[model samples]
Target: ELERMNQEINRIGVNINQITHNNNSALYSREDKHRLYVFLKQIKTLVSQVQERL
Candidate 1:
């Protein structure tokens, strides 16, 4: 579980980074930006919980 969570955390981090870069680049539609933002936040919360489990 910890290993899976760790991999997910890394994946989330990559997604967050890509979205952030795209956001900075001013390329995403407003809705996509909002969705990615929400996803990133959820990923963060999940990572936190996973860390506690660890």
Candidate 2:
């Protein structure tokens, strides 16, 4: 489970980097921004859970 979570966190980090790259090329639409926000929230929650487990 910990490994899975770590992988997920890494994946999410990559996704965020992609989003930032896209934004630099051209600003993201409201929907895209919202999606990014959701992803960030999920990452935060996952990290909190992992911390609690530790």
Candidate 3:
């Protein structure tokens, strides 16, 4: 389960990185910004859970 979570975190991070890189060239639409916000929240929640377990 921990391994799976780790993989998920990595995947999310990669997606966020790509989105940010894309945004560097163009302005983010409202939907794009919302998606990024959601992604950040998910990462925060996952990290918090991981820390608790550790």
lDDT of 1 by residue, 1-54 (tens): 767767877887787788788899999999998888787788778767876876
lDDT of 3 by residue, 1-54 (tens): 878888887887788788889888678988988887887888798789888997
| Stretches of model 2 off by over 4 angstroms after superposition | none
Model 3 pairs whose backbones collide: none
Candidate 1, poorest ten consecutive residues by summed lDDT: 1-10
Model 2, residue 13: displacement in angstroms?
1.0
Q: Looking at candidate 1, what is the lDDT of residue 41?
A: 80
TM-score of each: 0.75, 0.66, 0.67
Ranking by lDDT: 3, 2, 1
lDDT of each: 0.79, 0.83, 0.83
In model 3, which runs have C-alpha deviations exceeding 4 angstroms?
none
